[model samples]
Target: MASTEFDFIIVGGGLSGLVLATRLTEDPDIKVLVIEAGNDLTSDPRVNVPAMWPQLQGTTSDWSFKTVPQKGMGGRMLEVPQGRMLGGSAALNGLNFVVSSKDNIDAWGADLGNGPGWNWEGLSKAFRKAYSLTTSGNIEKEGPVQVTIPEEDTKWPQVWRETFAGLEYDPTGNDDPFSGKNLGAVMRTRSFAGNAYFAQARSRSNLTLWTTTVVEKLVLEPSSTRVTATGVQYTKDSSETKTVNAGREVILTAGTFGSPKLLELSGIGEADLLKSLNIEPVIDNPHVGENLQNHPVCVLSFETDPANEEGFETLDKLTRQDPATLAAAMDAYSQKQRGPLSKTNCNAMAHVPLPGISTEEGKADLARLLNSTSTAAEKGKTPSAFAKKHEAFVHSILTNPRKASDGPDGRFAPPPSVSGDSGGHFTIGVMLSHPLSRGSCHLANTRGELAIDPNHLGHSLDVEILARHVQFLESVLVKSEPLASHIKTKRCAPRPEMGISDANEAKRFVRETAIGASHYTGTCSMMPRELGGVVDPALRVYGCGNLRVCDASIIPLMPRGNPMATVYGVAERAAEIIIAGL
Candidate 1:
């Protein structure tokens, strides 16, 4: 029963936890303690190498969990990997840094009735506050993080740019709210400093980050209805149980899975479920482990001849960029903190609308169809019948862009139609950013450890949306002349049944082989108490006084792009709220 105290006790040492801890400790008078359930980043090479992310997929640095059998995915379980290191998932994810859609943020604010601050204007400030931009290729700050865009000597950047241009999307300023359409340039928001990972930015002077410490419970004060999270009980390296006391608060930043499990283990979840586990309910918050949402992503890989890989070959070489070349780039960055490497990888993203959209309505008619179970019913027919109907539908959607009726900034114009007959081979990676299906995260046992049940592809519509995306890829393969030349064969899971050119067959193929984007969120949602909200507008749990959740779990809906930047932005804002409250 040894006890240690701090002015602020932050759980989990990932991006959110670290950001809050770092900000809190900035004031020398305050003490911040960060307890992590994973290893430190100082010696982890997998975290440092920008090109090694795919290899780290299921490693020890990842909390490699799987979902329950998805009914829409032909009853198959899918891998869900979360970062288990000090930097959290940011340490092991595709380094595509793009701000989420402003529409998504507005929806979140509307849902919470929080007004403008929760909208884009408020979030934009937070994004700038946390990150010091150095685009145009430079590393101005000697901070612990370094972001560089992938080198442009490669063909990938050019091809990506052309594709977006072909779609008629504005290529610059996609990351900035004030910037116009046509956002180009890959965001260089990675933590790479030279050839190594930058761990210092997340590391702080007063923040004591204790890795390999798995929190098992939150000890609350006995008398007050307000949750005085006095301390936490955790297992050290999964071998020993230990308790550490917090003089003031216990903030849970253990991510979607770990955070909710902590709440449940502390008896703060659904009463019936806790009662089933023979644990008495403390807070009776049914939403503690509900509302799980993640991006469902499907990649279409193209195998091209090494000789045809001329332009793209630059990417391979860039991965092996020599010290001299890197040094020169570094010098350029040092001078101005702006260079090619300082930009983001994705240049543009299009929000295509389905048919029957109105320019002034702002309502997403296509999203409705994508979210409709009827689409699934249409796609779920036997393979032969589906392919017959799917092909034409796919072609129409790809060549004709749908504009969101009633977009916040007025309706975006329809994308330029690619020559329906043009040819070239390219893979279309379809990602569903905002999914409606919800799941849950609970403790595996009485001891507090996360049992992540993502329920991936839980709803029929999720599968339908992915199916539509796949159809779009197929259309590109068959319709475009240049794209068609590069395509040797269609490669992916549940390989299309031989000679099964029907729409039904394609639908079946998509249903059987779809995968996830690994962006799990919303297990501990921030909403009003009436809507099964786990935390309030300030991210504090409804019944708990001093405890707060400042990670992706607080996001009520999945954003329309990569979530890392948003996660960082949210953490920054949460830090401000926490500080203001104190």
Candidate 2:
């Protein structure tokens, strides 16, 4: 029997793991250990600064993995960036703190019958627990994360709210976005932990964290018919390998990409892949590496007229192109939390369905392209591994309870000014709220890094939906008042010159412009065994005792907006689930 160093051994010290460690250690008696691969970046400017999020990609803070050339996406490869630091992507991401609607949460829980605890009412409590509700009546203020809701009088958000209200695209319906309906333009909250979520928890003497350490695999001991996970195998430097036992459970909170890779290495995936990798099969669970989903986004930017330059232009200067400007902004932020650094990459948001959202002809055409057999032809390839399941997912997203009328088919957010940009910027983007595409992350060898393929826009249906949004936003929607008057030049991606009506042209355009929203989920989905789920609704990994996953990886589906708030809530609920078992 291995010596148990802690009651729970958490694999990653990322967002979810930190939340779990804090929750579990509140009892001071329970021992927990968090093993993190990246160095503790608590106060690293690359992490704490919201504007520097774009700068961190492909840098030390990012995993910097690239997708296998996406055949569906004009044979172009995408830069799949995952945070390698302490808070994981949460620390490296654009600080847009937002949550899903009640209807959206129900789709993942009650509607799918996941569990009572997974539903809206159940998770809403976790939402409040994770962040103290601010004056916006949306987020929490006193929690580990400091959430700043943009004042109603703020310039960009004010303009966006008025523009959206006049258009009647979708009324916000309620003041608090967390109350459920978030349809109109509203200023969003941004999370600033002040390097705290884990730092503050250091006072809890029962917790231990290993930084700059890599988790090799899980320590599974088999007994006759079943396998029990006792602990984890990890190493600080390749020269030394150590095993830390977990008396209660071994939780894998290693994000969407890291968790599934850990499971595969531990011999809990498809038999063929394991055999090929020379790893012994312990569970032969095919679902362990399947069901990967992420939101696909595209930005359509326009050059704002210099004469019409308002507060939006000041945003461009704050990107810190000059040393003096950067120093000045930092000085201002220290004095008062109100500065350009306080703003998010996106200032305001809206959700809308295209003009043809309900048309029969549109649906039929999409169906033809998304059909399991024909989809490969669109990509100029043979059949894909997940063709049929993704085909079904495509139809479901379009026909689910959250369709054009109630839940938006796509989301729109005001764009941030880019550094070194020639002119003022105004962008309208299309968000594939529920993407049909699937991808996987698995190890090719015993190496620390894992091979990943997000399968971006692999489904032809996504291209069709996003193309429609682009056409509508530019030709039909943006051509409307206050918004149209501000645009001076046609400096945009999927340029206005491209004929969007032509299907081939639209497909080519979508392929060229699409980018990942970094909201990766469903890799280690919590669903029923029959549906090829890796984890149960209780968050326990199937076919294993004392092994579980608590992170974005367990998110069975992608929610509407930024996943930070949702991920935080999931961690909060995971604490409840783990406590019940204890």
TM-score of each: 0.78, 0.87
Q: lDDT per residue, candidate 2, 394-415, as tens digits? A: 4555644235421222112224
- In model 1, how large is the Cα lDDT of residue 367? 48
Residue lDDT tens for model 1, 383-470: 3222223232332332244422111110001111211212222344566655545667777677554556666666665555555556
User: Which regions of candidate 2 deviate over 4 angstroms?
Assistant: 1-4, 136-143, 151-154, 171-174, 181-196, 311-314, 323-328, 358-421, 494-497, 501-503
Best by TM-score: 2
Pairs in steric clash, model 2: 131-140, 132-139, 132-140, 132-141, 133-139, 133-140, 134-139
State which candidate has the highest lDDT. 2
Cα lDDT computed for each candidate against the true fold: 0.60, 0.69
Model 1 RMSD in angstroms: 8.7
Tell me each candidate's RMSD, in Å, in order: 8.7, 4.3
